[model samples]
Structures are given as structure tokens and as C-alpha cells.
Target: MMRVKNFAHSTFATTNHQTMADAQALLQKADKKAASGGGGGFSRFFGGGTTNYEDAAELYIQAANAFKLQRMSKEAGQSFEKAAAMQLKTDEKDDAPNTLVEAYKVYRKTDPEDAARVMESAIQMYTAKGNFRRAATNKSDLAGLYELELSDIPKALEAYDVAGEWFSGDQAEALANKAWLKVGELAALQEDYARAIARFEDVARSSVSNNLTRYSVKEYFFKAGLCHIASGDLVATKRAFDTYLNLDPGFMSTREFELLQDIVTAIESADQELFTEKVFGYDQLSKLDKWKTTLLLKIKNGIEDEPDLT
Candidate 1:
């Protein structure tokens, strides 16, 4: 029995563990009936034209909880398994068991190999119900996990490709999510920023009046500018910064923004000697590369987005 945990003062939160225990007990009882030799597992538990879906699902929910707590992953997976079966019989399609996700989460944590085996089961459940898209989606997430957590980049790329086929172009939020994740991942890995900048730029362009337009173009310009700086295109970098500051004249923390404004002033004035000290040589930017690149990117993201205090 789980002590009731406070949920925002509503105070009626039972742990998932309790649910799992009840479910396990139900499965055991059903198993016993099947073992008596008269009925096969499927018919005795889910068949016989005797539909008590409400009871079956309730049992499953409890089992899910128990499996989660006791870490009986296989049992928990089966619990959601049983619940999904019950739902189908009752035509309670809306009651599609969420147990698959629950089971997958647990199974992945301890036994990843088993988790892959279980994900197939989840796909089976969704496919049986004629939900092809959901099956595909779950499969994609599963593959992504393998790629990211398991370090299977090729497999991960495959998953991402399949997910792309899920018509994400029509779904702004989902597309944005994938794009954001890719860009951030590449940046952290320091993989070529050119591709990342392109991804971010796509997001910025698409956001113009729909999903992305919420943030100003100044942000996009800043991002693109940093990419230019990284690729050693000083000329383009200045152009990006120029656009960024022009969009928000009083933008940035006073000192940094002023520094940038000074750079612009110097560059425009054609002060070769003064600007030489501020900028870097591509060949010369070795050990301290990331910091210099980061400083440039930060200058763009912050200055353009921040309001002018000066």
C-alpha cells in the first residue's frame, strides 16, 4: 500500500505500485483458471464471449502500478497487454490501454534489450487496433531511444526518417520539436554548424506567420550570424550582426550591446587596426575556438532579443 502522496493539496494520489499489485493478482487468478487444463490462456482470460471489460481494465491498471513499483517489468507489460485486450472486446476503443507506454518506460530503464522486445509488442497492440500511425509513431520513438541512448546513430537516423514520413510537415509543433532537438544536439556535439544553421533557419522561415513567427526575426538573424562566424565568414557575420542590431536598436545588456555598436562603428569607419584586435584569424583560432564562436553566437542571440536599457 502506497502512502497517499499530496498532489497539489488534492491529496488523493495513490502510487502506481498499488495499481500494479491488483493487476498482478488479477493476472494470477486468470492464469490459474487457464492452468486447470480446461481452457487455453486466451479463451479463459479474454474469450468465451463473456465480456467484462470494466473489470478486466481495472485489473490491468492496478497491475500496471504493481509492475512499476515492484519492477516486475514483464508482468507489467503483460498487464497493459491484458487491458488492451479487454478494451477491444468491449468496443471501448477510447480505452486503449496506456499500459504499453508505462510498461515500455519501466522495461527500458532496467532491461533495454527486453524493452526492444516489448516495444514490438506495443506496435502489435496498436496495429491490431488498426492504428497504423500510432504504431509507427511508437516505433519511431523506440528507435530514437535506441539511437540516442544506445548510441546507434544509423538506427536513430532511420527512426528519424520514418518519423518524417508521418506527415510532420503538416504538423507545425511536431516539426519544430524535431528541428529544435537536431539543432541543439549538433551544437552540443560541435558537428558542422552549417547544417544546424540551415535547420534553425528553416524553422525561422516557417515561423514567419504561423508556428514560428511568434519570436522576432531578429532571433533568427542572430542564429544565422553565429553560424557564419563559425564557418569563418567574417564578412557575412558582420552583415548578420548588422541586421540583428538594426531590428532592435536599443537591444542587449548595455555594455555588450555598446561593444557591438562600437564594432559596427569601427567596421563602417574602415578602421582596420582597431577591428583587427577585436576579431580573430581563422587559422589562428585553434584551442580557444569554442569560446570565441560561443561569444559571437551569444552576442547575436542576446543583443537582438534583449531590450535596450541604454
Candidate 2:
């Protein structure tokens, strides 16, 4: 007989190892009944006409914990996947997607391909249930997995856009903004300046319209300006700067903002030396971030060649 580890008013948290052993034995019994089409499995476990796959799912979860405790990552993930599948077969649809996500977490560290597969299953389940918020969150996770683990930028970008669409449709403004920001950043990384600028501008306008935060609008405008600078569109950068000044009530004439105007002025006066010096000066004072530095370098490279568009 197994000794009880702890007991409360109406429940207990058993010792995991003992529970694992018991669950393994029960799973064997369940597997035989499941295969034989006997009365021992889900169809009769709860004494109801409705199936009760929860018993099998609980056993699978216990087995997963056992494997995880033994440091067998692959087996643990497989067991969790089994649990998720069993959960889906039950009447509890909401918990099934969550169970699949648990399997995904187990697989993510050991096998990204397996993780991606599990995440796709979770996404489908959530979408089918019209749980757009959860679906969008899972899509964002999948996007990160593709970008960071699988090194698939195009797929990552596509996933982010899909996540953004779901968030937007669900009227989740903050989440939608985050998803679209990823899409914009990826577009900028791919040197698609126009698309990046458009995405940033849209978010910035939305932020203003919804009265989200002035700082957020400033940051988006900052990003849009960098993208315009990257595309060597000095006129557009100036216009974006003007729009930011108009919107931000707390606007100050910082060197970061001034550099945009200076760069425009330098190009109009045909002074490549002045443009370079002003940009470098801003870097010395404010220390540009890597993304800003990258776009600034691109601007400096083409500044002398591109005619004044102001």
C-alpha cells in the first residue's frame, strides 16, 4: 500500500514517485482495456454514458512527471503529448489546448521540430474554439520559436502577422501592437524600409488615437524615422519628425530629435561633412542603440550620393 504524503480537507498531493509507479501500472491496465474494447477504459470510468478519457490523461501526466524526474526529456515530452491527446478526446475542450501547450514547453528545449509541431496543434485547437486571444499568444510563441530556434525569419514574420491579425480581430489592442511591432522589426531587418515605416506609422497613429501613451508614440516615431533614414528618404524623416512634435505635448528639442532636422538641412546645403559630424555627435552624446546605429550607418553611406529630397 502507498503511504499518503500529505492530506488536506478533501484532497492530497501524493509523492510523485509513488504516484508515478501507480499510474504506470494503471496505464498498462487501461491500454489493455482500450485495445480490447472492454469496459475498463473511458466509456465506463465515470459511470456515465459520456466517455471519461480523464483517467487515461491523468495517468499520462503522471508518467510524464516520472520521465521528467528521471531526466528523460524526450520520453517526458512524448508522455505529455499523449496526455494532451487524451484530454482532447474528453469533453473538456478548454483544458486540451492548455495540455498541448504543456507538451510544447517540454519539447521546446529538447527538440524544436517537435515543439513546433505541438505548438501548431495547440494553435489549431485554440483557433477552432474561437479563443483568439490564446491563439494569438500561441502564434507569438511559435513565431519566436521559428525565429530564434529554427532560424526561419520569413516564417517568423508570417507568424507574427497572423498573430497580429488575431489580436486585432479580438480587440486586444496592446497584444496587437506587440505582434505588429515584431512584424515591423523583422521587415526592417530584411531591409524592407517602406513596409517597416508603414507598420510603425500605423501603430503610432493608433497609439495616439486610443490615448495609450505619449512615450509609446515617441518610440514608434523614432523607429519610423530610423527606417526612413535607412531608405535615404530625408523628406519623409523630416515629415515624420514634424508629426511626432505635433502629437507629443511634452516634446523637447533633444539632440536625438534635432539630428533628424540637421541631417535634412545638411543634405539641402550639400554639406556631407556636416551631416556626418552631426550624426556622429549624437552617437557620442546619446549612444545610439544597435538598430539605430545600423540604420544611421546606412544613411551615412548613401548621404553623399543621394540628392536632397527636401
Best by TM-score: 2
* Tens digit of per-residue lDDT, candidate 2, span 1-310: 1334334422533455555566467557545433433244554665522243566677677777776765566777887887777666666667877877887887887788998998998999889988989999999999999999999999998999899899999998788888888888888988998878888887887887665464567678777777887776677677777777787644445555677778767766777899888978887877878877777666677767767656
**TM-scores for all predictions:** 0.50, 0.78
Runs of candidate 1 with Cα error greater than 4 angstroms are 1-24, 32-61, 71-74, 82-97, 112-170, 174-184, 187-195, 210-216, 224-310
> All predictions: root-mean-square deviation over Cα?
10.7, 6.9
Model 1 residue 82 CA deviation in Å = 5.1
Error of 2 at 286 (Å): 2.6
| lDDT of each residue in 125-173, candidate 1, tens digit only | 7768766567667767776677656766555545554554442543535
**Model 2, residue 153: C-alpha shift (Å):** 1.2
Which model scores highest in lDDT?
A: 2
Q: What is the lDDT of candidate 1?
A: 0.55
